[model samples]
Target chain A: MTLSITDVTKRYKIRVTRAQVNALNGVTIDLPAKKTLGIVGESGCGKSTLARMIVGLEQPSSGTVTWNGEPIFDKARNMLSSKHSNIQLVFQDPYSSLNPRQKIGDSIAEVLTVHHLVEKDAVQARIAELLTEVGISPELAHRYPHQLSGGQRQRVSIARALASQPDLLVLDEPVSALDVSVRAEVMNLLIDLRERLGLTYIFISHDLSMIRHISDQIAVMYLGKIVESGPWDSVLENPQHPYTKALIAAMPDHTEVGNNAYEAPLKGEVPDPASMPTGCAFHLRCPIAVPSCSTNAQTLREIEPNHQIACQEVK
Target chain B: MSKPLIEISNLTVSTTDDNRTLVNDVSFSIAPGEAVGVVGESGSGKTLTALSLLGLLPRGVHATSGSITYGGKDLLTADRETLRSIRGNEIAMIYQDPMTALNPVMKLGAQLIEVIQSHGGDTSNAMERVLTAFSEVGIPDPKRAYESYPHEFSGGMRQRVMIAMALILSPQLLIADEPTTALDVTIQQQILALVMQERRKRNMSMLWITHDLGVVANLVDRVIVMYAGRIVEVGSVKEVFTNPQHPYTAGLLASLPKASDKNRTRLLSIPGIPPKPWTVGESCAFSPRCSKADQQCRSSLPVLATNTHTDAACFHLMGDNS
Candidate 1:
């Protein structure tokens, strides 16, 4: 059950104006079964747009997103109907995602009953089992979302996602809102669940440490395009793109304090997606940008085995 | 050595409803030109501590006991007029969200100048001072940014504007409460660097409150770890990070998903949530989540014991009285 995204592009046309904003441009990736592919970028770098496209929440303006080589966005078939139980998305904010008035147990039961994943008589037992599997007490299944703490509410969100029996989970900033200790608990739970359920993940977060910790493969996005992608170690240890290097350099290292002065490789805000700079979107902030970088746009090119970078300066 | 700039002793905050203590017997100090980071999870009372320094705690919370001594004068007992004079002149603050912290209807220049004028400084030189501050904090084209409203600036830019506002008066101390939590990684680096640079340039002391240990490790000269409204550990950054005596501190460091641990999958997380202030008992507050806790730990609370390098509030630690 592989999920493949090929040359997917998404653009939003502004209302009351004759302007278009490109959210995701020419994105291509493959998610093999039971593997984690981490996507990281700044706030407006279109990571969420790609996640929305994959989950059938937003259709791409062009290109294709397929499951087992079948286009999931075909107009002939209902969106998310044929692939509802196979894929799911875990949202970033647990507080806003869950229904305020609904009990957590009923929430899970709704997904199960709506998808017809289980029989009516066994739904309550399945809800209790799902709640316990995500490290929440089965008794809390009766409590409302507000009654639970932030960590517990996030666990309930995960349980709701799991009730659909998804093979692939697109978790958007799953643990970013959690405290450090609670974040670890959630990450550990995800690791255990992935192994137990054989689930693939497209984990999206702006946190580099969490991405490096969980992802087998990583893709770095900038201005609606992927600038770098490769195996986790290769990309993190020997990053080829300037944007990736700047991100690595910007991550706070505990050992560097009082030992040496800090060095930020890049500065300045990311360009507006609507009016992105020509050539490389990161060229404006690239420390080593050359003369030709302003006019020559670069595409993802394989520099080494399985390592790709999209900068012309990298020989 | 020179005299300490600020001394807070036995600070305690309680709610008006039941008089339950939310910040209990907390004490720390900051020397001139030093930076201290207060780190804790939500409800650990770190934000309350920072707010108490300026007497701006939210409604329903009140400071019951403590002496906030600024330059050998008690601020907690000072009259409202004294606090008003010292607030923007001698001490300044920046909050977590700059968007809401700033006024929406006023121009950036008007807000910046208002802070200077309200402190009774020379109003004639206010515009010049605002532009100098804006440029100093790396706001490009300060002249243009001054005329724009708060909504016109980006998140990082608005935070820079907040920094400019805080430093315009040349305060001796700056209290930043989660200043960089809302920023992206690259922009957070920029803001941290800007703050540190300004701190050195002005020779000012700082009290930073945040939850990210990694940020605290890099930016602060000293660290104070709080839990359940009590100081769990206090030490220099090197001492605490290298050798954490408290189990809670160790749990926090271990729980982080480090970049170096790429090959490792399972994270070593401390089980259970932090105890609420209302649910706290006579025993150590962290005993429920601590693996090394014993009968004594669950029966009585421990005072902060001192060593050559660090101070920790744990009975099992090898240390004498502070």
Candidate 2:
């Protein structure tokens, strides 16, 4: 099944000041069946907000998110419909995501029981199978979150997500909290699972290296806008947007030592989401911005067959 | 090397009550104006080693035996008064989280002034110095940032403020413990550039501790790899990254997802989690997870020895001949 998010915008209203925080501004993307779409952005760029909207955790303020031509949210009930269960989200911090007091097996079992995916009698066996699928020992099912290491806790988180048998998995920085070695293990597991189960993935991370490893398609986000989108190789090797180029350049390469000096591209930090810059959201930090860039809004336009960029200066 | 700026020899730090060793027999030296990067994973004792240098070990943890000599004086044995004089004047430090390091209630400018005044620095034109330091670190608007509190600034700006405060005294040495780990890649590049600029301007020595090998390769001249509270490998950045001698170093390098690897092969991950501090024994601490470990490796510890391209503490070197 295909997942389409069209012009999804999310705004959070500040309680005290009554000011609106523009989290996601007109985010639009389409993911075909069993394809991996990677979203890369710095903090406060609305990547996570888009993930939440895709998984039906939060409804969009102004647009629609559909799965197989059906809206995921029910307008009458004002909540997620039954079809939303096809999408599951795995968070970055495994320790906070898993319940501290509950046993690992119990957490997985709770998901299975709520979804009624397995019978009551076969619950224990199903739990064992799930644990084994994620490379965890079935014997440790009784262990609490504190007793397991970070890697094991993350495996349990994955197992819980798989209990729903989702068609789409939105991984929000799944391995960012993990160490490098353990991050490899989790990433490998994800690649294996996607192949075996024919799963669609929407991976979000700030790390370009990790994104390049698993993504088939890539989207670069900046201040609640997608500035670049294309095949992973095209977007990474010959980046079009200035922000994307800076991100690729800033990525530390061990082999390039002594040859390249550290250059800070795209000066200054990301602007505040509440009071975004006038025209292009990145005009404030764009190194090649013209005077008209401050007044003209930019939209994604196809440069190549499948590659798209949103910058005005890149002819 | 022109008189090593700081030399640590046989340094061992342990918890006072349990006598559990956290950093065991770790030793390295940073020459004057040289930048050294200490690389390790969590619980690898890299931070503890850096902390011991500044005499900032947490409560209940004490250096059991070692000598941290700086400029012909043993800082480990120095008195409180001498340490107080040397702390922010001759040596400065910035941590991973600037929010916690800074006082949230105080204005950024006032806090920086306090650091100068507490060190008995010149009181005249203190505001000017603070603003100058702020501008040097690329605070955009030094005057506006000076009046802002820690909570008001973003993560990147706060780290710049921390770097500004750490460099305000123009210390001879700066010990940065994962200072850019929490920042975005773009902001991290900015901070690294700032640190490089300041270090070059002052000819200052630096001990940068981080888990990222890519960051180490980009920033530091020399690299020291630590695992389970011991130095696994030591060499120049080019030698270590190009030709790693230790198995752990090789595994760490292999585990990183390289952008140049167009094939998208599976990452080579280390088998198990790092051993807890108390579980490390007399034998090679990484033997349990190392694929090349033998009975001899499990029975005895290996000291640092010369290898092909670097000095490594391993019975089975990766590319060694003879």
Candidate 2 per-residue lDDT, tens place, A1-315, comes to 898889888899999988889999888898898999999999989999998888777888998999888786552133233332677899999999999999999999998887678889999999999999999999999999999989999999999999878889999999999987789999999999999999999999999999999999999999888999999999998899999999998898876765526778768889889888989989888899999999998999999978999988999
The 10 consecutive residues of candidate 1 chain A with the worst lDDT sum are A75-84
Going through the candidates in order, their DockQ values are 0.68, 0.71
Task: Quote model 2's TM-score.
Answer: 0.98
Clashes of each: 0, 0
- Write candidate 1's Cα lDDT for B34-53 as tens digits: 88999899999999999899
- Cα lDDT, model 2, residue B16: 96
* lDDT (tens digit, per residue) of candidate 2 on B1-322: 7889899999999999999988889888999999999999999999999988889999999999999998788999998888888888899999999987899999999999999999999979999999999999989899999999999999999999999999999999999999999999999999888898899889999999998888878788999998888899999898898889899998888888988898889998999988876687878888999999999899999999987799999999999422
TM-score of 1: 0.97
Instruction: Please list the Cα RMSD from the true structure of every candidate, rounded to 1 decimal place.
Output: 2.1, 1.8
Query: What TM-score does each model's chain B reach against the true chain B?
Result: 0.97, 0.97
Query: Stretches of candidate 1 above 4 Å error?
Result: A75-84, B318-322
Query: Alpha-carbon error at B273 in model 1, in Å?
Result: 0.3
State interface RMSD in Å for all models: 1.6, 1.3
Tens digits of per-residue lDDT for model 1 on A195-236? 999999999999988888888999999989999999999999
- What DockQ would candidate 2 receive versus the native complex? 0.71
